[model samples]
Target: MSEPARDDASRGYRDHPRSKPGPGSITRRLRRHRPHYLTAAAVAFALVVAGVSAGVQSGAPVDSAAAAATPSGTAAASPLTAVPASPAPAASGAGRAASPKATPPPATAAAPKAGKVPAAVAPAAAHKPAKVPAAAARKPAAVPAAAAVAAPAISPELDGQIGAIIAANSAYALGVSLIDLSDGVVHGYGVQGNFVAASTAKILAASAYYHLVETGRASLAAPMGGTTAGDQIRQMVQQSNNNSWALILSAVGYWGIAAYAASIGITYDCTVNLLTPEEMARTLELLYAGRLLSARHTAQLLSYMQNTNFETLIPPAVPPGIEVFHKYGLLYGNLHDASILVKGSRAFVFVVYTRGLSESDMGPRTRIIQKLTRTVTGALF
Candidate 1:
């Protein structure tokens, strides 16, 4: 044994440090501790398996607990939390087949605070309507009923009567207009026909002078045509005095008269002095309605008109109780009468224009006008 121990050192050689144990020694030691090593390895493997199984079981329970804690109405946590989806609608027999899985209820929103606007919510599935056909969708809606229209002012029966009257007296060129003050209805035949205005246009000059007086540009008492302005107007209107009319025309230029006529809605041509029955009626209507002059001036002018020097055409035919304020014009072939007939709470304006008449003799045309006045009064009143 002593010799063996010193053998390597004595020989000038060194043993390798990494040299393996001898085979017999290794085998014998392995044999002796083999059972213990195997037992320990088996025990370690079983412990690792048990740890993994316990981790899996515990994860399941934790997930189940979390699921149970959540409310039934709420959706599961997800990346998209703002816009919750609406519930699917129930299936109908006529529609597509029903899905196998049940539809989840919509998520409940948090209650809004006082004065705070609630968040927009998806509409309920039941409230949605079924799909309609393209044809049905494009159909137009029914139109509503229209309102009633107003009736015409001139009745057919009255119009026929006037037509008969006009036909009976077709010999002369006649234009007539009648205005019913009660309803403000105007009906006429040949109302637009033009004729020589004649002295009936004296009202225009008188109106122009009154307009100036009203605006403080002139005075009623101021002298004109060797008489006061008031007296001159009275003479021109009541007596149809050409001298007074000429004086007034000169005082108020043609432009002034035109401007005054335009102010009252009349297009007056001073050179031609042409007028229609409707124009004369409108002028009288304005005066009657107190639209032309002040109350005092209107009363004064109307007074002058009532007892005019010439009342042979309209005033003579009017009934006694009703007062007539009228103006008549007679020139070579043109003859006209414009009148305002008034009673208590009743008034009317009647105008008639005629041509092909003799200035010296107006009896036949005058009788026709009287008959027309009677016919209108009989028909209307």
Candidate 2:
């Protein structure tokens, strides 16, 4: 059965008859938008009331009851009459407030009256009774201890020293990298441009040649004359002699250096003699970690290389008792750059390479390199 469509006018006053609407016009619009407006108004009013009574830091309405609590649970003697003035509500707009029938305040609300004024809002009564005195002044909130600890900042004094040392050592492209090896902490200029690797390349050559010797394909003890070839390699590393390098290179063939370098995790251009600072640093780290070879092999390798009589530059920068496995290469084309292989718990790898300088210009720069290296290692260790 069909029924007549009811008129909006027939509905109660809530459906404002004067504004009766067509299906697609006012009625539809009000149906969709009225709830949204009501929700927005409610949120806005709540914000205004909250703002009116809020503490500056907390934005929480003043918790007079919480503030009123004392060690004792008894009601206080007086409920103090404070000025009725309140902080302004949110600047957005005045919110609708509940209107109530006016009535006299209860005796509990009666309080000390000041110079003539209307009814004032009484402060909350304290919990403790008159028998016990109240706190001197309301105690400030109990401060919570900070959860996170701030690590000591890197001191400016340290930075200044590094700068001074860098300025002094103009000969070698000297630099430092501070790292937490286990946590992969990186400090200073770690992944930057290449630094000249002077005799450090020999470290790679030594590794390859020795690996061959250990396998019996190449023999370190094989005598070239009255002297053994292995003994000659030992002398060359300890002395930084050219003849020893030429001998080892010949034995470790042209392809052998590249092959062995890759195996040891040195991926830079092992074809030629040049390598970046990062490559050299990584090589030293791998060796220190004992990943380059077995422990026995690694210890022997470090022993043969640590003879520092010829690695004259960096040795002077360190304390006399400290141990360092390092090498220095002097080529006519450029200034000398020393590669230092530091071992032990505070393991570090340092490279100081100098370029565009002759013997005259190199003195200050090389000295600077040594001073900075000494300072950095000492500070870290």
Candidate with maximal lDDT: 1
lDDT of each: 0.67, 0.52
107-198, model 2: which lDDT tens digit per residue? 23211122212122111111112232357335543532231222212233444566566555443554444332332222343223554555
lDDT of 1: 0.67
Please estimate how well model 2 matches the true structure, expressed as its whole-model Cα lDDT.
0.52
- CA deviation > 4 Å runs, candidate 2: 1-164, 167-172, 175-192, 267-271, 333-344
For model 1, where is the 10-residue window of minimal lDDT?
90-99
Measured against the true structure, the TM-scores of the candidates, in listed sequence, are 0.58, 0.53
Clashing pairs in 1: none
lDDT (tens digit, per residue) of candidate 1 on 262-305: 99778998889988777787787666655677656766777677
lDDT minimum window of 10 residues, candidate 2: 90-99
User: Which stretches of model 1 miss by more than 4 angstroms?
Assistant: 1-155
Q: What RMSD value applies to candidate 2? A: 25.7
The candidate scoring highest on TM-score is: 1
Please state every model's RMSD to the true fold in angstroms. Answer: 34.9, 25.7
TM-score of 2: 0.53
